[model samples]
Target chain A: MLDFTGIEKERLRARWVSSAEAPEFVEEVNAFIDTLKELGPSPLKAAVEAKKEEQKEAPA
Target chain B: MIETIKQHVAGLLTEKKIAGFLGLIEKNGHVAPHLFKDGESLAGFTLGDRKTAGDARYPLNKTLVTLSRAYPEETFGVLVRGCDERGLYGLFRLNQLTEDRVIPVGFSCPAELSEACECRKPYPDSLVAGEKTESSQLKKVAEMDGKDLARRFDFWTAQFVKCVKCYGCRDVCPMCFCKECSLECEDLVAKGDLPVEVPVFHLTRAMHMADRCVDCGLCDEACPSDIPLRLLYKKTAQIMDTDYGFTSGLNKNERSPLSQMGPAK
Candidate 1:
């Protein structure tokens, strides 16, 4: 729903299912996991991890 | 022009039409906001020559709000350019001050001054000094509008990374009178994070400014990082105008659709 681009757009998904539609919810979750696998790790998370590593190596 | 303004203010003070006049004064080789009371002190009032415009532009409306809140019963006159007058109108809509309690002495800006600000309206409706000139749109916003979504996103993300989270923009904004700002909220924006969260901090501010921003460009001037904040807020104003048919600070009686509770008419 946000103005994200390329793989960033694939990183998020939303679906509405009734309480009785357990099969549909499961299918949606699986589809989201497959999409996540295809897209690999999130760029924002990678950037944060890299910053944390840099701080760890920095001299006091 | 300065003499004319001085005389006008002196007349107001002598006639007791206002308890004080809020305007600029030259002191210690600098110009700053001062409250002029007695007619005799009108000689000290100044418009601050063209050269001082860059450094001398103060949030006179914000000062007026503070003074009025303190006094409550007193009336005051203020020297206003186009931007300040727009701010007053916005404040009046927000119920910060009533129209009857404050009088505005308006003036126009020169072409060079207007060009520097990328101002769309450099003269107030009640102009008493200087001739009204054509307003200019910001060239940067126009250029950015033609770029692809990805390219525009990249440009904004790069600019947002430069932010030091100073909050100078909010402090200098005349319309930002909210006692509790979302920017300070720990949920929306985390505390003690360098560079702040990308796009969230700014986007939140942009959303808040959409209905209220008068396009004064003060936030742009106050930004230490030169982040082109005015351009972003100007785009928000454009969006509001296109989607909701609302223009801030234009009509005192008309309320922005976003501020109204019911469905838009």
Candidate 2:
């Protein structure tokens, strides 16, 4: 799992990339897509199930 | 601000650069977002104080998303304040817009707005005019963090009770691009009452905000009930920060945690 701490430290680097740099933007985004290849599918099932149980326990 | 924006607007249109520009226009002493076509009369184009609008939420973000989808081939420029710029970034991440098709005319908001909205960066990467200033806004999330759990619950409950169900919150949100909303989901939130009962409606909105909300405060402004929806979403953002250490709309390259899974390879 990726450490959550490093995420905020990452700077939002934005420049005035022109239409001519469209290819560069595409390449950069595509490269970013490759980095997240290992995180796999969302782990929301457990979270959602726990939430439902908690909701059931709490008075509605 | 309006005079400078007008000159820029006139220049862009005269150059035949963009099909239309989106910005606030003074309408009956209230500021509302309007699509300004190149040749249209410019009399109505003026920026007004957001506070006097009564309805704090500016629908510019929603307008851009809708227009971008409707006219994909045409180029559109928008006068984006910091919040609007973040909203645009969120829309871009969702594939609602491409970088080349939209021009973000950054306008540095006054300190009052930045403080009121608790804004971090009051400038965009590319700006047309105005100097960036230090933000004086208090982070509501930080304030809420000081409160006890019971107090937080009571605070939100009382706020939610005022909702008029105007749907202006969702309607004005730049990130709320979905045709069908979870708030309208039959299984989750009930639809009849104004200011939905307790956790269902607001919590549902909060859950959806996990990695989605950009903290624009437009939702809070749009709410007729004056609910601090931004605080709840900010809390959710803070939680995401705990596990994922990420915030929304700051990075154009980062894929939202909710939309994608795995490492940042």
Candidate 3:
């Protein structure tokens, strides 16, 4: 069921890499990259268009 | 004006009436808000040409409001401007602050500051400083209001896109009193993003500001991106003035149009 209360586990971005061939850091970095891929491109294009139009008429 | 303020404080303290006097204190070339007591230190109490470290409006207002909330039974004095007075008035309308507990020391803003702020009134309901001056109507509000919706959207979106999410604007806003701000809501504003989305981040703040914004222009200054935030809030205030024929901080009895609507008696 979808949590209606909107409480989600705290998503943290932290990494500790020890000297000499840290496989864990590389794995975590790769995982973060995969998450970014899942999220896909942001939806800022339409909003950017809207904002440009407003500036044309504002006072200098 | 300084002497006048001191005299008033002296009287209030002599009568043991007010708990504190909230006004400007110049220490080391900085004029920030300070709470003055009877016998502590009045030497630093000098007021003139306040060099704003990103809108002193919010800091001063926050001090008074916090003091009032902490000490409910005590009365306090507040130095106010057209913007500060209007913000307080808006707060009063919203039932955020009590007028009875606040003594207003009104001052007229200089021409440069007035023009920069585009203030409608440089004086408050009460006066203790310089003479009253004419109100300045910011041309930007009307200009923006006349724009087509798409153009308006574009302009504001670009402005919001540059937002650093520093919360300086919210932090410096004297009228912003929400202990839990909607901007901080992970769902609405999103978390861990530098400049969250356009309408989502800024638009939410603007909507919340609606009838509550006092056109202090502090938010604009506090914003590192220099987003024309004052123009947006100014627009909101204009809508309130036009639609309801009400302005903040002028009257003690009028309720803020946002939470509760009261007849303009």
Candidate 4:
């Protein structure tokens, strides 16, 4: 669905980690974070920031 | 066609086959859903035709859900297009209405109506009247699929921005029988906000509808935002069909794959 909405397929990741394997979970998280860093912030960030700015600028 | 339906419904009503026939009525040049308690009231019955036949549609199944709840003992006959029969199958699965308590009086859509709706199935399994037409391909959805991701994003963003948060789509949907709606949840969606979390709001709805959507197109017509919601749901339905090997709202025995508590295949 994210792919359908133009978000890069790399933006979201899923992995099954056992609760007993803390080290494996850490490794998976680190790997996903590295991938995200390479992808940079989502394009939706700028649009959301702009919306917040517009809301702030509006008279209370 | 209307005459045949009236006679059939009349026979059902008189024979105690149905407690009432739930169908659209034309009164004072206006069309609305009404329950005919007996054959004599057939004078006001219509095929929901106005300027065009098979227009002036209503979510009669939603009404049926309420009616069934009030009088669980009674059986009812209702007007059914292909989409509506699909909804009945869905409703039965959801436990909103039982198959035994409802009888369908099926009719096929006019060619123009079928074309306009881009209906996949324009007629039910059987029709009491009107010739069956071929199913329509989702032309708009196909067009959207051919676009690059960037163009798709921009198109959807602009469409979602027009939302006034009226919730007309949910209200008008027969499948939307949930007492508590996730859309209205304050945590998921911030209240008192215009253009509410554009992607999240609609995506949530699309995800929820993936398993349940009957491809009725009522949501598209009800949208005050004029969002092509049916197209979105249709796209999701395609994914559900191709990936999970399930076409939604088809059989009473089949449960939505998502509804089953198990690991994805």
Better of 2 and 4 by TM-score: 4
Q: If scored against the real structure, what TM-score would every candidate get? A: 0.83, 0.74, 0.75, 0.92
Q: Report the candidate with higher lDDT, 3 versus 4.
A: 4
Give stretches of model 1 more than 4 Å off: A1-60, B50-55, B262-265
Pick the lDDT winner. Answer: 4
Best by DockQ: 4
The lDDT of each candidate is 0.80, 0.68, 0.70, 0.85
In the range A1-60, model 4's lDDT, one tens digit per residue, is 766766688877988999999999999999999999999887775765564565457732
The DockQ score of candidate 3 comes to 0.10
lDDT tens digits, residue span B134-229, model 2 = 765446666776766545544555555556677788877778877798778767667685436454566667777777788878787667767778
In candidate 2, list every pair of residues with a backbone clash: A35-B264, A35-B265, A36-B263, A36-B265, A38-B262, A39-B262, A39-B263, A40-B262
Report the C-alpha lDDT of model 1 over A1-60, residue by residue, as the tens digit: 124211266766878899999999999999999999987875654454454455458622
lDDT of 4 by residue, B65-86 (tens): 9999999999999999988998
* lDDT per residue (tens digit) for residues A1-60 in model 2: 011111111122344567889898888776655555543443333433454455457624
Candidate 2 lDDT (Cα, whole model)? 0.68
Candidate 4 chain A, run of 10 with poorest lDDT: A51-60
* Native-to-model Cα distance after best TM-score fit, residue B215 in candidate 2, in Å: 1.5
Question: Per-residue lDDT of B35-110 in model 3, one digit per residue for the tens?
Answer: 8887765677755455642234435777888888899888888777777787787777667788788877777777
